[model samples]
Target: MDLELRHLRMICAIAEAGSVSKAASALGLAQPALTTQLQRIERAVGGALFLRDSRGTRATPLGDLVLARARLVLPAVDGLQDEVTALVGADRIGQYRIGATNGPVAAGLVQRLSATRPASPVTVHATWSADEICARVLAERLDYALVGACDPSLPAGADGLVWQPVCVDPVWVLVGERHPLAGRAEAALAEFAGEQWASAPGDGCFTACFATACARAGFTPRPPLEMDVGGCIDLVAAGNAVVLCQGTVRAMPGVVPVALTGSPLRWRHLLGWRPGGPAAAAAGELHGLAVQAYLDVVAQRPRYADWLGTNPGFGAQPVTAAAVSRR
Candidate 1:
């Protein structure tokens, strides 16, 4: 029998489970049938891939080699399937579907797009995971993804997507009005060394970036309490912990977002879509609207607007001439 993708998957499953019986259960196959299939796979490969001991199954050198190749091949094949599915089920000509992580831009962008194209049906899906949003875009469930990432890192699942920058905002600290640092125009990271930190849950590099910043400031950060946005705000307002937030975050009742002195951490908002897909035809218009939406949000936060004026490079990035022409 020729080695097929399913055979490779089964091999990987057995290697991962460390026992034929366990792998069979996980794969929803009877042990005897799985053993018969395994024998056929072994004959096709001309080697004993795994060794069975009384304890469990372990991969031989040949099995390790096969596993490594299977790992690479599987994801590539999966990506190809997603891409083909997207092409086959492209969005309707006048419809717009956007996926977004927690941020200010998505809502505003949707509003602007609906206004611009009154006949077009615009929709937005919210999530806490940029990777999930991007995968949806790749799978054609979303025409675009508006998400934020730590300044220098791109979202995962960006392989075949085109990402355009909307803006770069400084990361700020949220503290209660009663907190001593609340009155300060800007505070240093070292000042928060002993304070407990809380933040909205997200699948991004911000957590690692925050940790590195704290280490550079000569202290280790406590593992931050991860919760929804409202929970994070509650923690900050109660003075139980401080939260990291974007500069454009609006004022809460008792919480204020203060800039970090040296701007140790920064976030970049991005709008991504599958290249050459239906969204590509309107990418320029969508990107322009996204940038304007971000600017509008910044305007609502006077403190952040003034900070942007003083700190020139942290606002809307100039769209390059080449980028404009491409769009």
Candidate 2:
């Protein structure tokens, strides 16, 4: 009874679904069969990986350790399979696989790439984890990754990758049209001290960076409601909470994106890839396309473009040899 990749995947699915029955359904197996398999896995590992109760299932400490390793292993293994398959089918070698977290840049890049190279296939993989995107690039599953992180910090899992700065964007607030400050071009952070906050979930330093910014504004912020981008927009439209978003956030019907006075928090967009991978040959061209895409997104957001003119520090950064380095 040796632990295998399937076993690790089962463990992760159970933890994610929070119940064996749900996990079994998701994995297309009988509930009892899944339970038996879980029992065998527990025996092999010599411990109970999960604690089941009336509410739901939660991972034990041992389960946590197993899950961490599974996350790393699964991507690398999947990437290896992809690379092997691509090698067998040399015709697919010219395709561009772009990975990114939520933002307008990836979409813009894909559009530009398709227009410029009509014969080359372009695909975009979107995730909430910048580290996962970088991991996929390192594993050769993706040719390049365009991700954003808080200022002064690089994306995690970038040990052997080259990173180039695409732009520096100021974090802005999203408020409903009816909100008192919605009409203002800029609002101070302290103005929202008494309001509730919401934001999309991501694996980055933005959470800590936001908290520190709020603390400096002379008030402690409540734990923000973490949800997807759509959900965050819903909360703002309903006037239940305000959200923090990139300055280049698209215009919404009932919501407004307002810059924070003095730009207390900043986000840095980066383009990363393996040094000698397929993307290396066109790294300069790819980076230029990415920067242009960012500018295009900014252009669509008239208010943000206007704000950028007043704030020189918050737009595309100049790319130089100094800006491109291995992390």
Candidate 3:
């Protein structure tokens, strides 16, 4: 049997999903059919590609070799399709369907696009997690996503996507302005073990990451009050509870963002989209818009801004006062 583009894409999906069943569901195929197809592909390739385990499917040595080539081939095919589609028709090229986790950049991107391309329609969606946003983008529900990743590593299933690193946003501790630690330069994560945290309700991966980070600091954050980031700020401001927030967050009344002594918390901001798509084609413009927005935020908070500047190359892109403006 001649292995085709569909076969290659399926292999990549399986590798990323880490399970045949999950990959099959994502591809809208039955698990048994996917299993049979996987077997055939293995036979054609002359070796087993993945090893099944209780943990999940992991790529074998042969599988890794195959995937490396598949990544290159898949994007080349996508580029060809994008070019051809653009040449024949431009109807779907202008509209931007974008999503983002809670951040200032998403609003900035939408506003900037509206100001620049007044005729082009921009749709923005909000999800609690980047993984879900990435899934929607892969499904073509979103043209691109501004995602946050605390781990700094790309999640699985991003084989053919273009990811541009924007910055590393430090996660700050939010407390009432009247709180004891509010006036301090920094505090330790363990010091807040007894305090209640206000968090947004969601099954997003951030919940797990947050829990793990707190666990490492010697305690799990107590049961948090369910609320959006804005609501979290309100609660924190009223001296009701504390919450974690991004460093670039604006100055909310009655609340103050204090850094942790070790500064152990951070999340990488990334722009993710399919290669050769409209979003990928406009990656530089998107990055510049995000950088400008971030710089504006940094300027307002001198403390974190100084910390950000000193930690150059630590994931936050270097931007000068001049670079913040268009050339």
Candidate 4:
């Protein structure tokens, strides 16, 4: 009758899949068995967790509330299990789990970490938002994450963690190669007002940072088309829409990344981790590794690299002791 981790996971799976059958399939349980289990869980929790209809299953108000708390609890429990397992088996001690926003930095970090510690197997989760990565770190699911957030918006709540500033990145506009303004070195943000934009939705501060920059340019951007990362880039390549992204963004075959006039959109690269954890203890070493990764990625792109060189302020700076003290 007591609520257990398995019970919480089952409800979460059902809520997310929006169907008991699909959730059962995902969990490798028989439909009838899952149904029986769900009934028992509802009895323990004192209410029906899901309302089923032809449309699909939906979480009830109480179910929704429980599901929110489950997400926060489940990851921490998983992390504790990993920690205990590591203590019992020294060989498993070096496994590093990381979450990061999708970009060259995350790719480069994985490559460098592997080379730096061949014995440590690296597991990565590439996401659209640094805030999500930091949340995982707080939950003890990630050793650390490379995140970026600008003024007026802090990444991952800016609480219960260490924040190490790695570098400053400017946001750039991307357009199709054949577009009229593609060859321009720099253009005012207002120049692209007529163009449609495609960007990944719900990326916390990223969407707001872009909007604030646009607002400063004397206009508000049109509502963006919600899509995945590939879709957003594809829209740019097709000349149908433009997108805004970090300076670390790679140049696509048919998509050109150009700077904005006066560098309106700027964000700082930060290393997010639990205070006094392994990451904070080894902060200097990780910071150096990240700097090399950024340089390596930048060197591969002729236009972006050239711009980066001329703009001396854009590259990684050494992580100072004072910066670590602030956390």
Candidate 5:
């Protein structure tokens, strides 16, 4: 429908906040201004869009479909604006749909990507699992996907693909301050094998990498209490369990990170995108910048350079503050 930009934003806001008044408050828009826009949108569609009730506004079955489309399309329209601006040299802009299994990678990449092209638009969405991200890239649903240091599972009927090694980040054990192992600089896996485990299981690499590290230490880890990064921190900090995460995980509140002893678990990031596609080159550019951002965050530590070293002659592009605006 030929709706105004406010109509789209109104729908998206309503969907997110679950109420028109809440959306209006969040947008700093008066309730009637938003109500009029919603009415216009619904009229254009020939029926009511939201099911208004005592609690708030909920999407009708039709409204839910429209809301979902608005979520995907409005950002895509912004992306189109970027691409057009870039073509005229008025901007360095493009739309990127990246699939990843965790938050830090998405957060850091957004920082660098926005820094690279401040005028360009970038949207990051989280996939519930790494396997889902991997498959999304292959199916062309995503422009690129970042896989964790992965197990060597092969594709059954793969033809053309480009897998660029991305970042190699140090994996650490997250523990409570009162825990016995926390005071030690490092502890062998066997030393903490019996501890209850908590982890983010969305990334196959993280799960396997940690579990394998535990197994190589000579015992199977009990089933983890799967949690998000915050819950993991809260659980571990309460002295209920031990968890593993990369360096940035230390940035969370209420959690202290400790180095692992014996053999350290090194996670190598893989940049997966379709080979020979137009995005392949862009994906490479993204990987280098992303790795640099991770390095910049952890430069004091030297051991986590494995994947950065994997790219031979990786200087395909020079990253600079000025270059961020140039794309």
Candidate 6:
């Protein structure tokens, strides 16, 4: 008569794991709480549920009956959680304010309406850094953010936010068209060991990758000029120096994309937001768009902003396979 879902779950977990401590870890609950559940269940059922030995807890005859029923009920409960997740993903709220890193995400943004609702107040702001965007969203000043990684280390004290996968950005070593190493399908650290690089500030993954690569090659690549990411391609094209470029900047013109054969390196873009907010509805649509945009680019959609010249309407043309194929 005292049987309940919580009691059933604890008993099943204990029976399966064979130990209360192990069950507690699996359920993210405390061992004391799990033990309390077991004791309460035994009293309610009028029989001890487990045969405790030196090894661990095991199901008694009565416990076996309880576990069998639990095996069936637990799966249904798990199914319910899955359905709730789908329900959340499919939800569309009317209006919400938003912010994102200021950049063209291929043509992905084209998949949108003017606002979430009919005349519902919605604002979308664009900024320079992912941290800035995430901060605004966490502050409740903005509802959601579309941002690329900044600090390779995810910000600490980010309990107020939730994250979703966006895309993987490959960091390409960029060299001038006339550079001696530009002719190769891939670039090597030895080719530019003593050369200067245009590096941006931050411990971003791309920057970390480049530094590590250079360190392995017995050299440290000093920046010819430390500036914003936009300026690196210009420096590379002018032959001032080579800049280890991220996937985000590879598609921009005036730079050649050279793969690194020696090690693994990639940058990730992520969409993040607070748990509950007005923007929840639009955040879902934008999250899907961001993912699609990333996929389109990863499939070598070309036409990356880095390959675009410093002219108005430059990004209008996508980078053709033939263009990057020459790499």
Every model's TM-score: 0.74, 0.76, 0.66, 0.71, 0.58, 0.54
Error of model 3, residue 33, in angstroms: 28
lDDT of 3 by residue, 152-211 (tens): 655333445677767877788889999989998788888898898998643234556677
Question: Candidate 1 vs candidate 3: which has greater lDDT?
Answer: 1
Alpha-carbon lDDT of model 3: 0.74
Candidate 1's residue-wise lDDT over 20-50, tens digit each?
Answer: 9899777655565467668768988999899
- What is the per-residue lDDT of model 4 for residues 1-327, given as tens digits with 9 covering 90 to 100? 577676788899999898999997776555654776688689889998899998999989999899999999999988887787566544424677777765556678779989998987889877654545765676666777776666324563446777666777778888999998999988999898868999773334566567777888778888778778789989999999998887877756999987888788777777766776566677667778877887788788777777777887776767776654222
Ranking by TM-score: 2, 1, 4, 3, 5, 6
The global C-alpha lDDT for each of the candidates, from Candidate 1 onward, is: 0.82, 0.82, 0.74, 0.75, 0.62, 0.59
Misplaced by over 4 Å in model 6 are: 1-93, 102-107, 110-123, 150-159, 201-209, 248-253, 298-327
Q: What number of backbone clashes does candidate 6 have, counting pairs of residues 3 or more apart or in separate chains? A: 9
Please give the distance, in angstroms, between residue 15's alpha carbon in candidate 3 and its true position after superposition: 20
Candidate 3, residue 137: lDDT: 74
Among all windows of 10 consecutive residues in model 6, the one with the lowest summed lDDT is 318-327
Candidate 4: lDDT of 244? 84
Assess candidate 2 and give its lDDT: 0.82
Q: Give the TM-score of candidate 2.
A: 0.76
lDDT of 5 by residue, 236-274 (tens): 889999887764453445566776663357655555667
Question: What is candidate 2's lDDT per residue for 20-83, written digit by digit as tens?
Answer: 9899777654565467668868989999999989889999999999999999998898888787
Model 4 TM-score? 0.71
Candidate 1, overall lDDT?
0.82
Which run of 10 residues does model 5 get worst, by summed lDDT? 318-327
Question: What's the C-alpha lDDT at position 192 in model 6?
Answer: 73
C-alpha lDDT (0 to 100) for residue 171 of candidate 4? 81
